[model samples]
Target: MHIHENRPGVLTALNQIFAEQGVNIAAQYLQTSARMGYVVIDIEADGDVAEKALLAMKAIPGTIRARLLY
Candidate 1:
């Protein structure tokens, strides 16, 4: 996910979504600047669960984009 606004709670929201969907986060990377934030989350989950989590993540405020890579 790429967050357009660098504010609090965005990462928490994303993590919550993953937790709710029963997705296991294997690893995560995050970088933030004054204007934007970038996150790469490595997860272990079924296809449907991953898709659900991605959808939930996209709904979070300030999320510019979210997609499943590989």
Candidate 2:
């Protein structure tokens, strides 16, 4: 998992979650504004991990949204 956040620790949390699930992120894009943050993850679509990862990130603090791109 990857995340774009102006606040610290959000990205690290996402990375840890992905690692625990054995998901390999191929590419990622992260952008932030004073108001919110955005995250896009590109990964090999092999299982439900993408969906789970998105859900996990979406549940985290400071995350406005999460999406998986195949």
Candidate 3:
């Protein structure tokens, strides 16, 4: 998943959401520019819950997009 934002606390918010969905974040990479922020999260979740988790992530404020990597 890739998250794009321009505000503070987006990462924290994302973590909380993942936790609520029982998704374990195995790895994360973040990049920021003067006008935007990008984050890639590698998660561990069962197939039954993965789609739900991704949709939840996309619903977050400031998240530009979310999708499965594999």
lDDT of each: 0.83, 0.70, 0.80
For model 1, what is the C-alpha lDDT against the true structure?
0.83
Model 2: residues with Cα > 4 Å off, grouped in runs: 1-5
How much does each candidate deviate from the true structure in C-alpha RMSD?
1.2, 2.7, 1.4
lDDT of 3 by residue, 1-70 (tens): 6557778878888888789887788999988887778788888887778788777778888888878878
Ranking of candidates on TM-score, top first: 1, 3, 2
Candidates in order, TM-scores: namely 0.90, 0.70, 0.84
Greater lDDT among 1 and 3 belongs to 1
Best candidate according to TM-score:
1
The C-alpha stretches of model 1 lying farther than 4 A from their native spots are: none
Local accuracy of candidate 1 as per-residue lDDT tens digits, 1-70: 4454788899899889888877789999999998889899999888888788878888899889888888
Return whichever of 1 and 2 wins on lDDT.
1
TM-score, candidate 3, is 0.84
**Deviation (Å) of 18 in candidate 2:** 1.1
Q: Is candidate 2 or candidate 3 better by TM-score?
A: 3
What is the Cα-based TM-score of model 2?
Answer: 0.70
Q: What is the lDDT of residue 7 in candidate 1?
A: 88
- List, in order, the clash count of every candidate structure: 0, 0, 0
